[model samples]
Target chain A: MRADMIPLAFRDPVHDSQSAFRRLLRALSRPGTPVSLPGPAEAPEPMGGPLAAIALTLADADCPIWLDPALSTERVRRYLHFHTNAPQLADPRAAAIALIGDAGWLPGLNGFHPGDAPYPDRSTTLILQLPALTGGSTVRLSGPGIETTTSLAPLGLPNWFWPAWHENAARYPLGVDIFLTDDRAVVGLPRSTNVEVP
Target chain B: MGIDLAFDDHGVYSFAYLDEMTKRMIRRAILKAVAVPGYQVPFGSREMPLPPGWGTGGLQVTASLLGREDMLKVIDQGADDTTNAISIRRFFARVAGVATTERTGEATVIQTRHRIPERALTEDQIIVFQQPQPEPLRRFIPHEVVARKLHAFAQYGVMYVRLYEDISRLGHVAMSSDYPVIVNGRYLASPSPIPKFDNPKLHRSRALALFGAGRERRIHAIPPFTDVKSLDFVDHPFTVQHFESCCSLCGAQDSYLDEILLDDGGRRAFVCSDTAYCAEQRGERTKS
Candidate 1:
């Protein structure tokens, strides 16, 4: 794709970043609940609105971001680099934030850093691109933020994802937290949540 | 003359005071706090307009979290009109231009010090607690390095032993306020300075409770429906303060009251600590 073809960043950087950050906060606090992104961001080809908004809001010069093989294209790289100014990391394990564009071809959950017990806050935050936020296999989630049991149907997740998620949840205070993004909405699945998929 | 504390110098402060990057960092830390439930997430807490130990922690959080649409409510010791509350409310109104409210129900975000509202909160509400001390085991273990090691292993035996020692010496657990509670059966966390009477409300509540200790540079949270158990011995049991008389102003037997002395002659009067809640109850009673 041409360099000029890439869309510009948020119209109002301050308000836009603040709004998107709050939405992401609420999404992660209440797991599996989709929160709307600020008015659609100008995204490069293959990069959706939610992911673009998140990249603009969160990724900074201090944080190093990694992308899955499919999303490591020059266009996406240029877009993120130009917008967020975040360094691109080749090693998945070293990523502070990992953008997984293709969930079906995930290279296993163990590849990423889960942080140490003493400093569990250093864990990787996975931004997984999904087909849809709803209308798929329903998974019952129970944990912090969940009152009783809440059901979420995030579409296009791989068969091996749930088992991997169970192992991740078992890590407790040390595991990668995930954000599942569709076109314009994102839902969080924190490591504390116990997932039961049928 | 006292230092001119007025911010009327017309210096262009950023929206909400903190920059976008700092807000994003705090926002990320808050998410992590909620994820871990009780584990404190360290952040680069910034110096605010006010001095330390003066609700700066809560102010930072309120600043980061405030939006144009949010209705903010600030209270100190459950009173909305106190100096701390008024100053914080005024600061936000000037900085973020958010609407300020005294009614607990009307507020979307409530920044508090030393007390939880007497009125129950719903899911839409978020309570930001100004924490002077974030560490629960700081009293038993002064060194933070040692405390971190103990927390990593979940070695809370010393905390229980302290409670046991309190029973041995003081007949009952003498600690009244700043009661420690176990969050999600994981890390033992300080629920700020809210009275033990308000501890039960922390367990599986509908509202999201966020704690910020700016001086300590730590932030933690208790998400809605999270399990929060007050630390107690099976035999000793956790108990809240009880009074023989109801609130003199609102006739609230069920509310938390602050005892006041009328004069040196020992004339005593009790009133609800949550002034707004008390006024609301009085209004309702008059209407009925």
Candidate 2:
């Protein structure tokens, strides 16, 4: 009962996790589509609700996760470790799942796994913490998910992130997929999404 | 003696007959499959209670994606009443406790073997296909390692040669079902033995199409509004099968028909392969 009050993890692990995974799945399938995430993960400072919810839902013993140094506080590490039991990797490239704690200090795409041509799926999925999902510069996206083109304004990303993402998309079957999460919402930007600034 | 109801109880097996971790793994693979849009993503295919060849891949995918609210549908060669479809549908009904439907329009997730439904699917709907063989280059390159390399380099010369040979020998490409389609103009994928007639449904489809090969241990996906091109040369363009006469039962000239032998002698009759679609058409006809 005390544990329930703390709310460090999902209240109903089975159902909550399933719901979260399904949301993540839908978001990934339809790129640039924002899906409301499950809340109340009792997240640490700077690690918003949605990312914490995602961490609890997807990460496990098998998938090694990497947290950006800025957000790698002892409390955040403890919370993730106690909840997910996923190994934390120091090197971003080695990580299957990478978390961008501060969008201002975003890393280059080369550091992470741009998986080989044959096994492009081996690349990492970046879970970036953004300021807000709406009200940012609208980036036009078109690809498998979008019927023609869709616009999403995800705030708190670096200026060069869009160009880097375009370069990443040019790689096609070899770029990393991403999840942009704010305090509440999460949107997926798959490698297949064709991003344009205008 | 009363049949032991204990085995049929809710807690006897995990929800949907698969552990959460396994489902998560499959889910991750599905995400990757959708992202790449038709590239084969290798997954740790788990053994189901059913036989290996019997829709295990589709079952695993369905089990992973399925939720309590999802309305499910299962079909084999477009028929909702086949043993394969019925067994799968019933399995989900028992384990997942989700609603099952025969009508294509009502289903949120339609797991199928060798056929896409006759009706057009909505954007929200997802189709999971039971793929016996996910790779299209296997016919030319038997070795898996070599085939992987060939796909990596985009060295599809052998596939073109094979098609060239078919045109030279047979007048036209002889492949009826399981036709190879270059997905998003990238990887060559098997369309799960669905007839060439249904291949057009795959191109820029409104619904998401997922292919699972349990035995082969591969999963692929074609996301909604994606381009899927069937392989054909300029001289011999891809063409679908058409019947001379309409369906003998429902008179559906446009629908894919199943030819049944009336007798050992030469009499044959054609009817709609999709039982539910045929029934729905009949119901509409009677209503009018």
Clashing residue pairs for model 1: none
User: What class would a CAPRI assessor give candidate 2's docking?
Assistant: medium
Local accuracy of candidate 2 as per-residue lDDT tens digits, A1-198 = 353233467887777887888888778877888999976547777788889888887788888999998789887888788888899999888888998889777657778998888789899989998889999899999988788899999888888899999999998988999999998878999899999899
- The iRMS of the candidates, in order, is 1.0, 1.1
What DockQ does every candidate get?
Answer: 0.75, 0.74
Taking the tens digit of each residue's C-alpha lDDT, what string does model 1 give over B1-288?
797777753246788888878887888788888879899999999999999999889999988888888999999999998899999998988888788989998899999999999999998899999999999999989999899888788889998998999999988888788889999988889999899899999999989999999999999999988999999988989999998989999899999999999999999999999988899988842111
**lDDT (Cα atoms) of all candidates against the true structure:** 0.88, 0.87
Model 1 — TM-score against the truth?
0.95
Residues B1-288, candidate 2: write the lDDT tens digits. Answer: 986777665567778889988887888888889889878999999999899899999999999888888999998988988899989998998888888999888899999998888889998899999999999988777998899888787788887888898899988898898888888877888898899999999999989899999999999999988899999999899999989988887788889999899998979999999877888888752111
Q: Which stretches of candidate 1 lie over 4 Å from their true place?
A: A1-6, B1-11, B284-288
Report how far off residue A196 is in candidate 2 (Å): 1.2
Candidate 2, residue A120: the lDDT equals 90
Best by DockQ: 1
